[model samples]
Target: MAEFDDILARAADGGRIEAEDALRLYTDAPFHALAEAANAARERVIGDDIVTYIIDRNINYTNVCTTACKFCAFYRAPKHDEGWTHDNAEVLRRCGEAVDLGATQVMLQGGHHPEFGVEYYEELFSAVKEQYPDLVIHSIGPSEIDHMSRVSGVEVDEAIKRIKAAGLDSIAGAGAEMLPERPRKAIAPLKEPGGRWLEIMEAAHVQGLESTATMMMGTGETNAERIEHLRMIRDVQDRTGGFRSFIPWTYQPENNHLKGRTQATALEYLRLLAVARLFFHNVTHLQSSWLTVGKAAGQLSMHLGVDDLGSIMLEENVISSAGARNQSKLGELIDLIRSGDRVPAQRNTVYERMSVHWTPEDDPSDDRVRSHFSTIVADLQQKA
Candidate 1:
């Protein structure tokens, strides 16, 4: 107990904790003690007065994918009847709706269609920027970049540069399900290597684009492997320092190829959250994933070192297809944060506070700012 207390004290004081210390804290520390240490660490970096959320939309541009990852339920083979790609016009329409509902960021995410390469992204990104110049296009990840580069017969750096020139604001850490070889291969064997993911992100950072780091729990990965994921991210962050935040989400087991597997328990998720805060001394923000875990767990995470409530995902399909049905409205999200004894602030893609909700009166209501409206998926299903 004394040794654990000493480690916790050092971590709460903003000192770095090694991988072994993190393992002990994650596996052996009492729940309340771990939460206290993590909250203290968070307070030492980000103040405890406010929690943040984002108003963003996830636009799945296509469902055709060649990489048939074992854990994915969102993609269809290219020649499948259910596979569909949104025309540029429909994509623009979704962005318009998102903007009208006060979205500051649009995430253009989808599977890797062999026919769609870097040029496809360049044209789409440029069109979005030309129309909605203010919308932050924080979309895609290292895996997508790698796929696009390969399909276009270009180098990875060239692909990143072309997309950035076409108005990509930053990258999202989506494909980083796990960074260790054992678990990553077991879940996503066809996906790029974990080290390659980090290297592409490093190249993006060098080219002046920032990104977030993510890990998807409950993919049958061991606790040590979870810690290893964080270690991999932290090492890369040590050199590039381009990761603005670290987000960890749980895997949705229903309707996916990894079906019949149990999701990670809420307690495990909370423990990982605390450990992540203590481990990533270099990462600035930690986001709570209310979209994957239940709302109750997300609310409790506020006290366990989570400072961001991710987004009130205006529309989501990929995760929804895998059975994540939790939803939140604009006002409801603010109340969720405020109920945790923290003010709610709306932030842009870059973590800039756009508006701060200091009190109930400051909370705005917009029914159109829905948490779930999968028009694309619905339309596709109807057509099918």
Candidate 2:
């Protein structure tokens, strides 16, 4: 196979690697060549060897979902015996645990509960903010916002505005499994359409709210469909410049409605990671998700153009409910980045540096910062 010399050079040199160009890299390019190109692009754009992580929690407020995506094992039907919704006080108590352990951001992601309209979110956000004035409410993506708008009999714009006014800090960009039709429909037919997700994201961006874009690959999506997903996000980003980071994670195949059909291998995941860093030139950050793909794979991503290694996720439920059992403590995460031979720094939702650990001595003493995926109220009070 011929090396993708020309394309690699183009991507590394600040040229916009088009969709077709990305496709070729995914298919024909030498694996290491693609990685090097991606790493070069990452350093060129973000600078230095400093990789960033956020001290955050993935909080699932309610598991009762109207959109029961086949790929999601976290959601429960409203009438189901196991269905549950955490009260605002419960949510607040969980946030307190996260904040005590050094978390600055909380990802309030869950399923689209049928009755959770704009007002529901408005109250939730308002209370969360009032209690934890310093914690950043990086909650809600476009799909949930669109669903809520319809539930409340309002427009997407109005839904977003009301939530933001109620102290929503930013969009989490969850639920963007795959932006193209084939794979999208194959996985999440009940969720809002893929294009509508982007539409809502752009609207939020226009209204001065920034978001991090995400792609959930390996859900029977072809390489072409994957590229198409990047294309869709890129097009929207060109317009609003709202995507602060691009995060690509593989699908978990446990306990979901899907047949557990096809999954992206580690190599394929690496290819996609490099392709994103190369293709998304306008995006400032590329996050490597260890929570979904294990710690080692996440570390490998640093050499393949990932500038951020995602979070020290204090709590998670969605991915775990689907059998994603990988775990990491703050010390282990720092070690993983160091094993990749890169420096690790703590970052906020917007990629602002909070703290940098240049050496082991710089590591924090708080070891209670492990992720807790408990749905029980009692477990939420107990620190990991």
Give each model's clash number.
0, 0
**Model 2 regions lying over 4 Å from their true place:** 1-3, 373-384
RMSD in order of candidates:
1.3, 2.3
Please, what are the lDDT tens digits per residue for candidate 2 over residues 1-384? Answer: 345788899889889878998999998898888998999998899889999888888788888888878898878898899888889898999899888888999989867888899999989999989999999999979988988999999999999899999999999979899988877887888777889899999999999999999999788888999999999999999999999999998898988887578788888888899999899889989987887888888989999999898887777778877877788788888888877999989988889998999999998767787766344432533544
Best by TM-score: 1
- Candidate 1 residue-pair clash tally: 0
Model 2: clashing residue pairs? none
Worst 10 residues of 2 by lDDT: 373-382
lDDT of 1: 0.91
lDDT of 1 by residue, 90-120 (tens): 9999999899999999999999999989999
Stretches of candidate 1 above 4 Å error?
Answer: 375-384
